[model samples]
Target chain A: MEIFGIPAQALYGQLALGLVNGAFYALLSLGLAIIFGLLNLINFAHGAQYMLGAYVAWMLLSYLGIGFWGALVVAPLVVAVLGMALERGLLRYLRDVDQIYGLLLTFGVALILEGLVAQSYGWSGMPYANPLPGSVDLGFMRMPMYRLVAIAISLVVCLAVWIAIERTKLGAYLRAASEDADMVQAFGVNIPRLIMLTYGFGVGLAGLAGVVAAPVYQVSPAMGSNLIIVVFAVVVIGGMGSIAGSVIAGFGLGLIEGLTKVFYPAASTTVIFFIMILILIFRPSGLFGSTR
Target chain B: MTADTAMLSVRDLHAWYGESHVLHGMTLHVGRGEVVTLLGRNGAGKSTTMRAIMGLMKKRSGSITYEERETITLPPHRIARMGIAYCPEHRGIFSRLDVQENLELPPVIGADPLTLDRVQAMFPRLVERRHSPGTKLSGGEQQMLAIARILRTGARFLLLDEPTEGLAPIIVKQLGEIIASLRTIGFTILLVEQNFRFASGFADRHYVVEHGRVVDEIAAGDLAAGSERIRAYLGV
Candidate 1:
C-alpha cells in the first residue's frame, strides 16, 4: 500500500529506524543541554566521550565476558568518573578565563581522544552483538526488541534526569547555581563541586547514549561525530532553557527525518539542517528557548 | 570576632588594582547591629573599598576579617558565606529570574534563612511583583528588591553601595525608613553614599575617604560643626 507516493512498509520501517535514532538524539542532546544549562560550556568533547563509552562497553564485553546489561550499567559510570577527573584537573583552572577558551580546550581534548581511538581501533567498524535476542510482534508490524528496549531505556533515563532537575531539592540548587552562581556559593553550596558534578552528569548521559548505540551502529571513532551535529540541531530546535523542550524536539525531529526518508529519500539527509535554518529565521531563541 | 559581637573588622587593609594603588592602609570596623557609612566625593574609591572588602576584584594586598576569620585570600563567594553581604553599585539581581526565584537563590546554604513573607513585609512592592521578572521592576523597586534579597540570606552585615542614588524623593524617604527599620531588626549596615544628606540621616558614624584612603572619621552629631572638615575633604 502506497501513501503520499511512498510505500507504507518503507514509511513504517523508516519511522522505526527514526525512533531508534531519536533515542540516541534525545540522550545526546539532553547531555548537551545539561552542560550548556549549568556550566555554559559547549563541551566539544562530548562526541569523544560518547565514543569512549562505546569502546569501554565493547572492551568490557570482549575481555571480561561482561553481559550487555552489565556493560550498560558500568560504561556511563566510568565515563562520568573520567569526566570528573577532567573537570577537576583541567577545566577548573580555566574558569577565570574567557568562556571561549573552555570550548577550545574541550575541542583539543576531543581531537586527542579521537586520534587515540582511531589509532587503537583503526578506522574500520567493530561489530557488537544485540543485547536482546529476538524481535517482538506488534499488531501492525514486527519490531526489534533491542531497538524498542533502547527507546524505552532512553526515555526512562531522560525522565529520571528531568525529574531530578525539575522536582528535587538538588535541582533547586542546580537551577540557582545556573542563574546566579555567586549567590548560590554565598549560600555555601560549594559552587565548584556542583559545577564538576554537573559536568560529569552531562558527560555520563552522552556515554549512556553511546552504550545504547553500540549494537545498531558500528562502534567506530566516527560514530558520535556525525550524530552530534544532528543532536545540536535538535538542541537548537528545542529551547536550551528547558529539558522538556530538548526531549520533545529531539524525538519530533527524528520522526520528521524518518518521514522524509520514506517520501523523498534524497532530501532525508538535508532535512535536519533545513529545519535548523528555518528555526533560526523564525524563532532565534528556539521553540522552547526564552528570548531573554 | 564572635558572630554575636563584631560583624566585620578590616585592619590596616592595603589593596591595589593592577598598577593603580587603592585602599592605602585603610582600617574600619562595624560592630554588631550598627549602621556605619563610608562617605566621599566622586573618584574617592568608596566603591573600590567595598569591592576590595567583598573580594570581588583582584587585590594587591588587604586583610578583610569577617566574624574574626581572616578573609584576605578567600573567594568572593566564600566571603559572602561568612555572613557579609554586598550590594554593589550596579545591582546583582538575576534579571531573567522572577522576583521570588531571585529571593529564593540566597538560602541554598542551609543557613538560618528568612522567609518570603518576612521579606515581603519589609518591601511590599516585591510581594506585589513576586511573579514578575526582576528586570521588569522599576529602579526604586529594583533597589528595594536588591536590599531585601540580601536581607533574606540572614546576613548579619550588609555593605550597600549607593542604595538611594538616583531615586525619587518619595522612594528615597521610603528607603530611609526601610534602612531604619532594618537596623532595628539587628542587621549591621556599611553604606557607601555620594548623597551626604542621605548618609547623615542613617549613619551613626562617618569615615570620609579620599583617593582610595580614609582621611578622617567623625561622629554623626558633630557633622554640622565640622563644615570646614567636610569642605576641605568631601567638598560638600
Candidate 2:
C-alpha cells in the first residue's frame, strides 16, 4: 500500500526515525521551557551544556573506564553541579539587571565552552558505542533497539517531570515563585536558593538529553550547536514557557520533519522554521502560551 | 512606643525605589494582638511603608525592630521567617495554581501554624472552590485565600495592604469580619486601607501617613472626635 505517492514501508521507516529525533527535541525544549519559565532568563548556554553532557560521558568512558550505564548516572549530576555553580557565581548577580544582558552573558559562556571543547576534541565527530545493539521489526519497518529505548526513556522522563511540576507541593512553589518571587519568599521559601536549583535542574535536563543523544549521534563539540537552533525553533512553535506545549511540539515537529523528508527531501531542514513562522504569525504567544 | 512592648516597631524608616525616594522618615508601631491601620490617600506612601517593613524595598534605612531584633537590613525571606507576613495591595495570589495549591504553597514557618482544615473552616467559600485556579476566584475569595495562606505560615504579625480594594461592599464586610476574627485569634495586624470607614471599625489605633511620613495618629476611642481632622487629612 502507498499513501501520498510514498510506499507504506518507507513512510513507516521515516516516521520511526522522526519519532527518534522528536525524543531529543522534546527533552531539550522541556529544559529550555523550565529554565525560562522560572528564572525569567533565556539560557543561551543550554546547547553547550548539552554538549558538555555528551563530553562528560565520553570522558568517563575514555579516561575512567566507565561504561554507558555509569555515564548515564554520573554525567547529568556533574553537569547539574557545574550549572548550579554557574547560577550561584554569575547568573545570581544578573537577576536585577536587564534580560538582554543575561542572554549575552550566556551566549558568551556557550562560546567559551565550545571553544574549549574544540581545542581539546577538534571539530570532527567522535564515534560512541551503542549500548543497546539490536533491531526490532514491526513488519512495516525495522526500528533499532536503541532508538526505541530512547523514545521510551524520553517519554518517561518527560512525563515524570510534568507530574513533578504539576502535582507536587514543590511544583506548586515553583509555579508560584515564577509568578511572584516576593510573595513566595514572604511565605518563607528561600526563593534565591530555589531559583538557583531551578536553573541547575533545567540545565541538568539538557545534560540528560545530551547523554541520551550521544550514542545515537556522533559525540562532537559541534553536535549541540547543530541541534540547539532547531530546538529553539521548536520552543518558539510550542510557546516559550509552556512545559506540555514543549513536549508536544517537540515530538510533533520531529514527526512532521520526518514526513517532509520522505515527500520533499530538501524541505526537511527548513520545515520546523517555516512552521514556527506560521505559528507566530497566527498565535503570537504560540500554541500554549498565556498572554503575559 | 518602646520596641520591647510592640510586636513590630519602625523608627524613622526611609526607603527608596531606585533613585526616587518613596518612604521618608516613616515611623509606626503595632502592639501584640492589636489591629493597627495606616490610613492615607493615594501616593501617600501607605504601600511603601508596608513593603519597607517586609524588607522588600531595595534601599531602606533606620531601625525596623521586630521582636526586639533589628530587622531593617534583613532580606525579605529572613524577615518573613521571623514571624512577619505581608499580603500586598494586589493580593499576590498565584493565578496559575488552584486555590488549594495556592494555600498550601507557602512554607509553614515557626510554631502554631494554622492547619489546612482550620483555614478551610475559617473560609468555607475557599473550601467549596479549593480546586479552582486563583484567576477563577472572585475578588473576595482571592483575598481570603491570600490571608488564609499567610495564616498557615504561623507568622504572628500580619501586614495587610488594601485587602478590600476593588471588592464589593458585601465582600468588604466579609473581609472585615475575617480580619476581626483573625484579631480574636490573637494575630497582630498592621493594615493599610484607603477606605477609612472600613478600617476605622477594626483598627485599635490609626496612623495617618503623608509623603512617606506618619503625621497623625488617632486611637479607636478618639476616632469620632478626630473625624473632621482625619477627613481633612485623608480628603475623604
Fnat, one value per model = 0.33, 0.86
| Candidate 1: count of backbone clashes, pairs at least 3 residues apart or interchain | 2
Model 1: how far is A16 from its true place, Å? 2.7
Error of 1 at B152 (Å): 3.7
DockQ of each: 0.35, 0.87
- B1-236, model 2: which lDDT tens digit per residue? 45569888899999999999988899888899999999888999999999888888989999999989999888899999999998999999888899889888878787998888988898899889989988799888888888988998899999999999999999999899999999999999999998989988778999999999999999999977878879999886
Clash list (residue pairs), candidate 2:
none
Binned by DockQ into CAPRI classes (incorrect, acceptable, medium, high), candidate 2 is: high
TM-score of each: 0.88, 0.98
lDDT (Cα, tens digit) per residue for candidate 2, span A194-273: 99899989999888888899999999988888999999999999999999999999999999999999999999999999
- Residue B145: error of model 2 in Å? 1.1
Model 1 per-residue lDDT tens digits across residues A112-164: 98889999989888999998879988777788999999999989998999998
